[model samples]
Target: MKRPQTVRSRGQRAGLDLDQIVETAQSFEVEDLTMQSLAKAMQVDRKALNYYVKDREALLTILAHKAFADEFSPDAIRAAEDWRDASRIYASSFVERALSLGKLSEHLWFGEPLTTWSLEANESLFARFFEAGFTDEAATRLVTMLSTLCLGHARDVIQATGSMEKPRPKALRAALERLNPEKFANLLRILDHGYDTYGDEQIDFSIDVFLVGAEAVLKRDLRR
Candidate 1:
């Protein structure tokens, strides 16, 4: 049997080799990722860093790609039994991965024009939905919805926690208490148990709603 050839990534081919840079950058807060700081950490001249990344925006794009690539694998989606399963896996994996990244998640949330690998990975994932009977337009919309849901949740969690590693129950309770009890009664009641306690529940609720709507759309499309 012949062995398959291994393909090198663009960074490796160009001597840009961004793995070290990405790893180092992830350790710092998103606000602190200036080119000079990254170059200093990498032991390269600031000007030389441009040889690999071109600019801060490019570096951020590469970092976003690295983070997503670590969490999402094309083969995993391919191995799923159905489009629904693939989407659930994608959303869950993406949210978990983004959360785990700490401050690094900001790049994934804000970066535009994702790297080639990231784009290709997303295309493959969405293509599975199309193959599963959804029209091209429907698949595109569904993908957008799912991605937005996950990213939005991640952003909310980040804001809620601020620089803290976890949500502070005391702080949340105090904030809720400060609101007018009569007008915000429902809001306070919902968060009485603490906002952090509902993270998993909220994620489940959002995913359930999305999947339900998606199924309805798919059924309607099929009937036409």
Candidate 2:
């Protein structure tokens, strides 16, 4: 495999350049890498790297964009045509991807500085949800809730149990099953009638509840 070299000639001379730094950062990530080690491997002076990037934070953002841009698979999410269905697919796919990447996923998604590209992708996903009849506020809240739930659950499962490789698809399927519209309606019924539910006593389930409530609210307003 030909290792891609960062362009370092002619038009740019910003001390190893952003491309080289980003490429080096990505290579480091692939090799279970670190920034200190990246500096060593790239053979660029630390001061030069400091001059090129603000700090490790900048380097990490570049690496995350590269990783997501190159490696993230949207096959699962793309299969669902409806916005609600797509949200389920997206959550599961993201969790699976995070599990595959292990610590790298955490570093990419949660580590500091953050990637604008990843943030924009998230914003776009929620925007799609809004376009599909959900209000902007509802869409944002729902996306935030689901993202936190799924990503945190994935991190817990993978990091603590070391079960990173998409543990029996059924696992994620079961989680998504909770978000079915009918099931959601049932929860609303329980809440309306003042009944308590058992198991998974966390805010993770709140998104499903909120989705149901939001849909009902929208329908009511539209009818009025």
TM-score of each: 0.71, 0.59
lDDT of 2 by residue, 18-82 (tens): 77777666655455555567678777556666766666656665665556545444554445576
Please give, for residues 157-183, the per-residue lDDT of candidate 1 as tens digits: 866674443455556567767776788
Which prediction has the highest TM-score against the true structure? 1
**TM-score of candidate 1 on Cα atoms, chains taken together:** 0.71
Which candidate wins on lDDT?
A: 1
Global lDDT of each candidate: 0.73, 0.58
Candidate 2: worst-modelled 10 consecutive residues by lDDT: 195-204
Clash numbers, per candidate: 0, 0
